[model samples]
Target: MARAHWHFPRTALAEHYLNVFDVGISSHLAFIAPRRKGKTAFILQDLAPAAQQQGYLCVYASLWGDPNAPHESIVQALEQAIDACASESKIKRMLSSKVRKAAISNEMLGRVEVEFANNPKSAGTRDLTRIDDLVTQLEKAAKDRTILLLIDEIQHLATSDDFSGLAHSLRTLLDRRQGRVKSIYTGSSRHYMHLLMSTQSSPFYHFANLHRFPDLGEDFCAFLQNKMASEYGVAVAMGSLVKAFGDLDHSPYWMQRLVERLVTEKCPLREAMNYTLELLDAAEGFEETAKTMKPVDRLVFLELADNGNPFSRALLSRIEAQTSNKGIPGTVQRALARLMEASLVSQIKKGEYHIEKPGLRRYLEKQVGSAPSR
Candidate 1:
């Protein structure tokens, strides 16, 4: 049998977010945090439930959920909400098998956002008028309850030029129903999220209040300690647990996996930590990624990870010295382009960037010295 879920509830935080929406401070909210940081869990387990209890008609979508039909993420959520208004049997029959496996209220875990939306190449073909009509229908079905839209990975819309039209349409769609529809968006890529919401030329500019999605802290560690001792009969020292969490970059996803390692393998915390790191490095493809990195790419990646200027003359000279290539602005530019294509780094602004795979840095630190591929 599967182990019972050990959720650390953030009911207070959920209420705080809901109250922000309730106060009409901003109908649109953009929350940014890295992946595996429990942002989605908080939304599904805490935020969405609280909203529903308070009479919210919650519709959640993950923009990248359907690899084949990504444009349909928002539409799909709306349709599922409509189906939810019908009889249980009818709803099951009308919706796909994915909807039935939901973990939270109407949150299609398979295509999750807790609710969220996405598209890259041609999600622009989405029908805006249909979206408007769907919202109207959901409003009627909601019986005057406010509609809360939980859109996940929303930064995907800003990653490609093709999604420009869709983004604009989505902005207009929300603008028209300012009071009726409230939205909370979560994005893992801080760079793209900034582009989507902060860039003046972007459709989403000033469209929402951007808030940093806080990471799981000591309380999360405490909760895990309680679960490990009570549920699995594994006694973990509080200091060790906190240190483990700190070592894993405070990622709840990996920390939970670490707990699983402790329970199943019946090993010490240090052994479990080592095992989890191996799993982490492998699961994130860090080893494979390292093999493909050119010396310049590695240098540029580390520079960006350190939040240092890749274009600085000093760093440019370092790259040239390390790779034996002419360390010029053009060279660094090319390296940056390659890193972006690798999906391991994000250029938040003209000359600014943030590391996408932080785990990769740790892997590289162990595998290769900072001096390029040398």
Candidate 2:
């Protein structure tokens, strides 16, 4: 069993579902959720083992690149994957040599070259060319093995071509009789991903194995309980911990923070509940100020949080009117713009909005629930 904090067995259910799907080839999976929900951990836990077991080369890319381009992100992930898989001395030696060679001979470099022992003539430049070259390199890397490409924060990818190109490139590899590649695409912003993969204009339309990383469930909670018992040598009150999760309101980040605080304080579960509420109360003024922001900003925050985790623009507008007594469309939109600027709300999907904070939903729920039953 993996560490309770780092791995989720619940992901196995997703893997099983993907394997059973009739998508007709190696599946592209998207694990979508809000931030700090263990989506990245889930990807790492599953993708790493699958790559090693299937004898596949895995590239885990972060889209937040040096220049913030999709292509750059891919290259970064490639270099990392190569360095990680390469023999330690060999990688250091090869990279050192590549840098040395590039510096010494200024050969009209339109593209950068990462040459391996088996493939010497490869020069990768431009996004498309680099992906093509990388695929070639990955093929060489996975001699008698499969290849797995795991891209994280894929929502940062802009343009239909960015994703479409990826899908088309993967299609080429999968179409081959000697194919040895599988992929998992993950993003924290589900709304953006839906627009990318589900939209008719998207190159990745129907190209991925859609998977939702669920909240920590009973089994995971039980795992946490066992870990607490063994690690601290104290039997945790499982019921209290469960109740704590409910009270923290099912936010994974907050849930983890609560556990950390409990462990640090050595507080009993019941005591921890009181302590947690106190923490929330202590932080309320600042949090409320953070929400007060501007009228438009506050409106956007409330709209997203109150409407749902994510709401389409139309839905948001509808709710704005329903909730506002002013009945001014321009006023509501301006308020939303302010919220977006303040970073109190984020557009997870194009033309859709979502709250960026945890525990905020409950605060809004109470406020709305008490509003003259409107």
- Write candidate 2's Cα lDDT for 149-228 as tens digits: 77766665432333445545545655553434567777755445766767676556777767676777656667667766
The weakest ten consecutive residues by lDDT in model 2 span 109-118
Task: List runs of model 1 lying over 4 Å from the truth.
Answer: 1-4, 86-126, 311-317, 327-330, 369-374
Q: Clashing pairs in model 2?
A: 28-209, 55-146, 56-146, 296-335, 297-339
- Worst 10-residue lDDT window, candidate 1: 106-115
Clash count, predicted structure 2: 5
Clashing pairs in 1: 60-115, 61-115, 61-116, 62-116, 63-117, 63-118, 115-150, 116-150, 116-151, 116-152
Please write out the lDDT profile of model 1 over residues 99-133, one tens digit for every residue.
32333322223212222333335554436667778
lDDT of 2: 0.55
My TM-score estimates for the predictions, one after another, are 0.84, 0.65
What's the alpha carbon RMSD for model 1? 4.7
CA lDDT of each candidate? Answer: 0.77, 0.55
TM for candidate 1 is: 0.84
